[model samples]
Target chain A: MTRLTRSAALGAVGMLAASAPAFAQSIDEKVNEAFANSTGWFVSFIFSPFPGTTFPWIVMWLVVAATVFTLYFGFVQFRTFGHAIRLVRGDYSDPNDAGEVSHFQALATALSGTVGLGNIAGVAVAVGIGGPGATFWMILAGLLGMASKFTECTLGVKYRNEYADGTVSGGPMYYMTKGFAERGLPGGRFLAILFSIFCILGALGGGNMFQANQAHAQLTNVVGDYPGWITGVIFAGIVFAVIVGGLKSIAKVTEKVVPIMGVMYVATAVVILIMNADMIGWAFGQIFAGAFTGLGVAGGMVGALIQGFKRAAFSNEAGVGSAAIAHSAVRTKEPITEGFVSLLEPFIDTVVICTMTALVIIITQQLIIDETTGLYMLNEAGTAIATVDGNSGVALTSAAFSSAFGWFQYVLALAVILFAFSTMISWSYYGLKAWTYLFGEGKTTELVFKVIFCIFVVIGAAASLGPVIDFSDAAIFAMAVVNIFALYFLMPIVRGELGSYLDRLQSGKIKKYN
Target chain B: MPSKIVVGFDGSESAKRALDFAVAQAKAKGAGIVIAHVLEWSPYSFLTPTELEERHKRRGEELARAETALLKPVVDSLKDSGVEVSTALKYGHIAETLASVTKAESASQIVIGRTGHSSLSSRLFGSVAGSLAQAAPVPVTIVP
Candidate 1:
């Protein structure tokens, strides 16, 4: 084992040396230009007009759907929040149940997928662009998103297909088709296919590619700039190994890594918050004040609202339907219990973790407001820039941590790699599932999809931020569009399931072993 | 119907010693031996639906493999020695599930191996034998 590892390390170094000339050729710029040119139309269409404003309608699609679900479920996310905790603790789980994993495992797997670069980098971007007020809206969106998570995951379990072998397949595709057919609704098959197609694209773009892109960014920032392709190749190789073992291997890694990384990152943020204890009150004040008054951002209240909702949607991914895939595998006879357990995901990913990142940035005084112009000091591209690193997004987040502890950038870099790795492996499963759903399941087809996924990791790393973020946002939002529509149609089924489950519980019919 | 002696078996050398001890106890007391293999499983690890399905399948394969390669040969040999024997394969927390199985089978005594893992590692990860000694519904004998 030692010899094999040494040889592998040597080979990697040799490859890096061989690729040295390619690094100087500006391959990332070319890839960025090519991606932007090819995908510009699709990207713009999905992120279409609020005319005279930068707000994309896709953001509204997710936010509005989340709000509607929250209201429609009579605030089920809040009402069942305690039950969700108990369910995750295995109080309600029967070991004899048919599903594959426990509720906690399902939640952890889903959380690992959602709680990646978005929490660190995306929050920084939101706060940078929309100012402190964006934090408030982001929190609200996360709260609303819980309802969306509840709605979809219930359907994920309710309408799931259990094969003769006892393995299950589900998500928007199954729910859309199966639930719609049960409801005597038309276009069930068509909508299922549409959702599956979007899921495949979204998994590749947002889940796999964007994670690799951000990880490469953080890596280069710490280790000094190299051709992103080098990071990409190394990342792709590692990701390929994990993902090729399939979901079990990925889950094993994510379950252990996600919780540790999350706690480590949040603990660091907490330490920073405590160290800047005097500024926390002032930070909250700015958040609340800027939320209402817009502070000094470009579009005022609207800009903050847009950035907050957009970033929150991107972060928690409540309406995006990917969590449904992970949640469906949980071992539970009561599908509604899984829904209750799943609602905690968005709260953890967005409301808790993302808030920590935002608080750290705010408490560190990362974003500077221009008092005279009533606007943020803009960079050449007109976006708000962080003063500490002269960079934004994840770099700004790194700077925030480094401000409190000088050596934290290295730690943050490690966290970013873990986050990126976990995200890629999870997304690889999501994409492969979608791929198999479309192309029919076989070893060859599965390998084909995995190979394509790994290649994109390199492409994503070798591309500039503009095209990568744009494409990711577009693909992910497109998935939300399809998934939310299916949810709207299928929520009555979820409502019924939740009502029945609650009745059994209230009547003391559902046995609790723990 | 003879009183039952439950033995935790994993096909390890220590487990072979444990089985021999259980056989002697069963022979002296004229009891039937129930050999149990409990696969340690965590309820906290994240898994995708596909992976979950694969795990469920792998679990089945593991049970079958244990039956064919370990339990069957041991059971046949014990039966040849004029001792009635049965085997069980289950998935859960090792000690707790073994205790549950003991109670369900009406087994009067339990036997397990002192796990080969180092003391430090066992302390870190929790030793099944130590836990079974404390928590088993019946008296447990540990064969080192």
Candidate 2:
């Protein structure tokens, strides 16, 4: 009696299986189209051009803020560079500090967050589009952004909220509200709200989605192509396990794995640079010359400047206010200590790590060079440097690495996955904090944001949502808009803290440990 | 002459024996006993930003829990004894914190139980007793 119905059911299941790919494809297409339609206006507005130029208003916003902070703080990043290293080494740390975190812990957590895909795929994107000159601007932005990080993190710690249960909460939101109010400024609440909204959305898009999408792409490069949803589901499950399920050991493993990968990736780049030792001078010559002349690169020097600053800001996240959230948890009584320590974030992430990636790509000659003109060759669209094997982003970086060591591609794949995983977990926390700020902090409230974040991981990987990614990029820069605005006002407070701390150091009021 | 002896405690049987040995030594010398309890933590491990934010709260709870469940009961049990006893608690590396407590309390000697932890971390990092033996600034007595 059951055989006939079971056979019919089996046939139906087989038919569904056969048509699943088509069904999934149509579903993905619809999702992408819907997101693109909705986010187009928002994306266009955020990336709107500056006056009399093709450059994005957002990029200009970050570059201008960084320059202002560098001036306002009197080039604090350069002045405090030595003190920052001392702080990170715990030289001035007191054993009696109220909390347990060290300067190193705070710096490591923030570094792991920023020194990820932005260094890998992001550098490739910059160098590929803007040519070698972009590296110059990128390094300049990173160095200047150090001051931005210092100012914001100083405010983050000073204006932070210490709850009765002893949990600490801070970031641009707190400083925006409290710092402005202390100065009798208006719209403080409004700015905090805007920053929180963008932080939440940016966390979802840039932090969760973009990471997953890139991790999937890297995996596909190493292995054969499969449905991105498979990767999405797996990543979501692991992230959910960490944030929601509270299986923190998984996160611990990834966090540990990522740093080792970072070191290995750096070592690989170092090896490539050493092998092509002769090209070292040539590469820097290309970087400096291309920065000015663009060497016939697409969009010329202007294009290089755009990609360089954009990627640097994206990589270091100095002015974006996210690092402020991580640094806010430090145990020090002197908020200025965190500021001094944080100046190193952009230095390490952008100046040191990103430059290494760029140098390798330039030295490896991944970008096609024009034989006749002695300039860079451009793709048919003239939008970017034409690359060997048409590679771009992480693949271009991978090709450059593998050019030196054939099996390095697999190592790069593993590194990309760990980097993505760590970034996802960190971003999940950043988004939760923002969500809680908007909707009062509570157990269930945090859970809702976490679940939504995990869902975005799936959406980002499974679907081709270009507009969605663009919207997230815009959202992050929007955070800088609100954050840098507050920092402009709060710089005086940081100046006071810095002055007193320096005086204390001079007077031996702050003990130096052996 | 009155002197102070610092004893490491975690409510383990080995710690209890160490405490007993310290009490006897203190009684013989007419000295005081400082029971030092260190909640082990490493600043080196990775934590999510969420975990980092809530760490202070969790630390407070753990300290409270250690005092009530681990330290206070043992001190209460010894209330009838004549030797003056006090407790010192902190969060840090076990050996370092104990040594710091000894220095802060100006204790003449340090006492700890030789407890065995077969976990791989202990294998890599060495047991608390092992580290304390090496790092203590004063004379260290490992009671079996």
CA RMSD of each candidate after superposition? 2.9, 4.9
How many clashing residue pairs, candidate 1?
Answer: 0
DockQ of each: 0.47, 0.57
The number of the candidate with the highest DockQ is 2
Cα misplacement distance, residue A206 of candidate 1 (Å): 1.0
Per-residue C-alpha lDDT of model 2 across residues B32-81, encoded as one tens digit per residue: 99998888777666677877788888878888999999989988987888
The alpha-carbon deviation from the true structure for residue A143 of candidate 2, after best TM-score superposition, in angstroms, is 0.4
For candidate 1, the per-residue lDDT at A339 reads 91
Model 2 misplaced stretches (Cα beyond 4 Å) = A1-20, A465-469, B116-123
lDDT of 2 by residue, A67-164 (tens): 98899878999988998999888787776652477888898898899989999998999999999999999999999999999999999999999999
TM-score of every candidate relative to the true structure: 0.93, 0.94
Model 2's lDDT to the true fold?
0.86
Instruction: Give, for candidate 1 chain A, the lowest lDDT window spanning 10 residues.
Output: A1-10
- Which ten-residue region of model 2 chain A has the weakest summed lDDT? A1-10
